[model samples]
Target chain A: MENMHLDQHISKQFNTDLEKLRTAVLEMGGLVEGQLADAVKAIETGSMRLAEKVQETEDEVNQYEVNIDAQCTEVLARRQPAASDLRLVLIVSKAIRDLERVGDESSKIARMAIELSDEETDPDGFVELRHMSSNVQKMLNAALDAFARFDVPAALKVMREDKHVDREYKSAIREMVTMMMEDPRSISRVLNVIWSLRALERIGDHARNIAEHVIYLVRGTDVRHISIKEIEKQLDQDQ
Target chain B: MENMHLDQHISKQFNTDLEKLRTAVLEMGGLVEGQLADAVKAIETGSMRLAEKVQETEDEVNQYEVNIDAQCTEVLARRQPAASDLRLVLIVSKAIRDLERVGDESSKIARMAIELSDEETDPDGFVELRHMSSNVQKMLNAALDAFARFDVPAALKVMREDKHVDREYKSAIREMVTMMMEDPRSISRVLNVIWSLRALERIGDHARNIAEHVIYLVRGTDVRHISIKEIEKQLDQDQ
Candidate 1:
């Protein structure tokens, strides 16, 4: 009877620890999302202050990555979870690395924001960029939701949206280069915007990586660089 | 007697698995190293055919990465290794991913080689480009050796090499843009070499990443994006 009581206590402790790990990771994800939003705002409104804020936030993301990695190690050592549970902790650990990378790219965008603010590109020229930003922002939120709910289909959709982000980025690059060629006065400003667009596109890629991990955890398959249309066919076959 | 027999079997089986993992990784490393060599050769000699070969080799590298990942997963499930054994498997898995990325970038170079072949720019004008290609190739080889022997000092040297690669890349970019501005006829070819330089620089970065991961596995520390001077200092401090 005493041994059974101790077993129950240990199980409860592990559950608490797992919850702590999940909360810690989700918190990190939230901060990255916030940085992305702030970076976009910085670019749109030409706010050096907001850009600085996004840069500062990356340090926190780095700390979170370190802390989460250490915690996952401890849990693996102590809990020795098998199959799904083990994959879950490992996935979270890897996903947080991607999240931290997202923070880094977002911070790069913030730097570009400051540079562009100094040069004064017209806000009108940033409409396509702003639209791309919103799309990536929405994708990030949906990805986080997919993680929170363990919703594989939603996560898959978020992954699919990354292609749109890439397409928008290519168009942005072409447009900005043309702008630079046509008016050398705006060259520096347009270049900074192009850098920011590249950063945002990368942030979207990392967010998509997180979504991929989420789906991997829930579905136990690798969805890396695979098309969503094919994935849909996969789901149908699975069911 | 039974316990002794079991211990012997476990040790023998563990030793064999470790040997297998090491051999597999080394083999994959060999293929990737060859691919990188071809990429540099293609660009340096301006051989579109060599570049095409590198691009074709990427499919083989991808197959190796997939094979190694599967083997690692199977080993993890079957052996459930701990301590150094666990670390070894995990490190190799991560290494394969890094190598595959290296292959991807080399393929990018291959594409650039084809583009440059069609470019009208005088191939004789790119002295700095030739030097940078050799530097990147040397770094890849050194980094591969660093991985093979877990040589921290060698890896530190490889990290220092990356700064030179970046500096050369920027110089090449400046030179190319100047050539383009001086003669619009130079745009297409100059841009192709610039893109190739960018890819080569990134390849150097990925090599540095592998070297850092080697340190991480050997020493359990993350030295990403940290200065080479500091990394060298840490290695000295450790010794």
Candidate 2:
């Protein structure tokens, strides 16, 4: 009976540890989301101050990754968690990396914002940029929500959203290429916009990766490098 | 005495597992290197067949990542490795991700090669592409060598080389932009070259990431998001 009591206590403590880790990851996700939003705003509004703020927040975002990684290592070493607990740890670890990369893409967008602010604002790609940013932001938010709720269906939706984002990205690039050819003088300035749009597209990719991690966590299936159609088929069969 | 023998057998098995994991990562690394080289060759020589071959190998590279990831997870769950062993598993998990991304970048370059082959071959940016690809490839090779040997100094050197690659990438982009401005008709073709150069530069970044993982595995330090000078300072202090 004493041993049983001890085991219960240890297991409860382990659960608390995992919960804390999940909370930390969510906090990191929130921070990255804000950075991305600020970056897009900086570009749209030509706010140097906002862009600089986004750049300055990069170190803080990186620190979160380092801290969470250490916490994960501690939990793995101390608890040796298995099954779902193990999956949770692995998911958190991989998700934080994707979040950190989103932070990086945000920083790149912020840098582009700074460069664009230096030049005469060319409205060639702003519409595309704004449209794509909104879509990506929604995708990221939905991905995090799915992660929090362990919603496999929501994650699958995010994956589908990624394909939409890719199409949007290609169309934007095509439009920009035509614009650059039409007006050679706008080439340099439009290039900055192109880069920013590229960064936003990459952020969407990271969000899709996060969604994939969530599906893997819930289903214990490796969904990476697989088609969304195939993933959907597998999930439906599992259900 | 019987328990001690069992302990010895388990420890031996754990060691063997770690060895196998390391070997697998190297194999994956080697495959990615081949893919990258072929992609570069396809671009330089305008070989559509080589580019197609590179695309076909991408699935193989992704499969390697999945297999190695599963092996790492299995080792962690079964052995519950602590200290250095735990670090090894973590490093392997992360390094394979970088490797898989490198493969993705290679595929992107190969696609560009196919596109350029269809267009009139403009010799504007191929020189920079070749130079940057070779540098990035060397960086990746050195990083993998460092990982295989656990050589911190070699890893540090790879990180430094990454900075050099970045400089080359920037100069290449500047040159391409100038060429595009001078010959607006060449804008579309030059853009493809620019994208390939960007992919190579990103590959350098991933190589630097792999080197950072190697350093973390050996020194038990988190060297990410830190300046190279800072990393060197920390290493000197440790020594």
Q: Which candidate wins on TM-score?
A: 2
lDDT of candidate 2 over B101-144, digit per residue (tens): 99999999999999898886557888899888989999999999
**Cα lDDT for residue A51, candidate 1:** 94
Q: Per-residue lDDT tens digits of candidate 1, residues A18-54? A: 7788788889989998999898898878888899999
Error of 2 at B144 (Å): 0.5
**Cα displacement (Å) at residue A97, model 2:** 0.9
DockQ of model 1 vs. true complex: 0.26
Q: What is the DockQ of each candidate?
A: 0.26, 0.78
lDDT of model 2 at position B156: 90
Cα lDDT tens digits, model 2, A161-231, are 99999999999999999999999999988999899889989999999999998888888889999999999
What lDDT does model 1 reach? 0.75
Worst ten in a row by lDDT for model 2 chain A: A1-10
Q: Using DockQ as the measure, which candidate wins?
A: 2
Each candidate structure's TM-score, on Cα atoms with residue i matched to residue i, is: 0.87, 0.95
